[model samples]
Target: MEISVRTPAVEPRAMWSHSCTLDDLVTPYAVDPTVVARLEAGPGWARRWTAVWRASRARVVCPVPDLADFPTLASAPVRSFTWQARQRHRPGLQFVLATSRMHGFESLEERRLLLALDFTGGIEEVLSQPFKLRFTAIGGGEDHTPDFLVLLNGTAVLIDVRPGHRVKDKDLVKFAAAERAAASAGWRYLVVTGWRRHVAAGLDALSARRRPMADRLGLHDELLEMVAERPRRFGDLVEATSLPAVARAHAVHLL
Candidate 1:
């Protein structure tokens, strides 16, 4: 049997372009063939991706199985951590405007992913170490914890952060289980192995406008009106605006 993976419906955009959505910015890493083969080894492995791997059948603690009940489910992170010296991975807290709180990250990659998420708008909340997933695999019962749970535009997204080459067979199994768990909750799941081409560079450039700036002159509308007619190169776009020097900052702010 041939098993196919679900790919996110996101489009790649240029660095200066404001055409992409939050979903577009957070690109999913390419699937690995070895990992796919390992996940597809078992007889019923393909079917298991849609199964519920919750805490239990009686009590649903992870989140709501329906989108309507999602709002009523209030939650804090299921796990906590303490910083220690000589650790292999860097752990720190970053203040995200979307949540209006400091969210935790286990590694630099995770931190970067958080920044990318925050850079895009419409992120309602971000919780680190959201819940403990109990899954039944061919091997047996295994528990796994996801990195982050992001509520974007009334939709929940479960995210796991691991480098592309660092993903092992066990990791694939856990991610599959997480996907199943997310599916049960009417949510989307993403395994962020790495960024897409030019995304890292694009994000870094866009970071300059991440924070708010005073636009007393209302250059945002002017720039929007100018760009609406046609796409312009970054340099030319700013120059064509009413106040060339002032429009430069607003141009990036619009992005």
Candidate 2:
């Protein structure tokens, strides 16, 4: 059987400045409280966010690409992966954005990292498998398609998720090409890994606060005062709010 491959016919334009840093180019995505509340109330909230609550809040800095002028990758053919029967049993996830559109994930890891990014107070937009770019001139040229394209603060980031142990020689070449493509476009490229453990728990804890009910019950202001005064346990913080048990529970989550 004959198989055909697609490639970029023209070289992409170099739009990004060499001296710009990721932080300077892209800001983190902002949280939408309404959207968070909706997701929290939806079915399977816990399952969806298992890894999100474990990722860290540390800012990631790198070179960014300029994606505004590039064509969307949606036109590219979808790529397929071959895995053993055991791997096929892994569940997929769908992320619902503030806009109510859904972005699908093929693995739990991808879903978790995406949730973390969504929960991040700094990220503004998240797109999955947005596009593909070719890196070589030969037949059946190598192509790099990032897993997610996110708009952080004000900058764009092209992210790829993989386990730390799975990164190999070929992956390095692909990463290098991705880096070059991202830098040229004034966007940042990221290879996501086990770092979700750093921020997920904190995010899950704070997600409850995104509900407007927290504001209505005065839990918002009260918790702020208590935490600002001195460090307190989550339970104590909840009790200090003077809210009822249910409200206290919500307040505790906010803390």
Judged by whole-model lDDT over C-alpha atoms, candidate 2 comes out at: 0.51
Backbone clash total, candidate 1: 0
Provide the lDDT at 220 for model 1: 91
| Candidate 1 residue-wise lDDT, 1-255, digit = tens | 233434456645454444555456554654455543433345554334322222322223433234225332355555666788888989889878777788999898888888888666678888788667655666766778899888877677888998766777688778876776676677888888776667788777777687878888989988888778997788999988779999987887777
RMSD of each: 6.2, 17.5
> Looking at candidate 1, what is the lDDT of residue 147?
94
lDDT of each: 0.69, 0.51
Best candidate, TM-score-wise? Answer: 1
Clashing pairs in 1: none
Q: Write the per-residue lDDT of candidate 2 for residues 31-117, one digit (tens) a residue.
A: 223322322223432222211110133222222232455433223213333356667534455544443456666677677666565
Q: Candidate 2's error at 43, in angstroms?
A: 53
Off by over 4 Å in 1: 1-23, 26-73, 215-222, 241-246
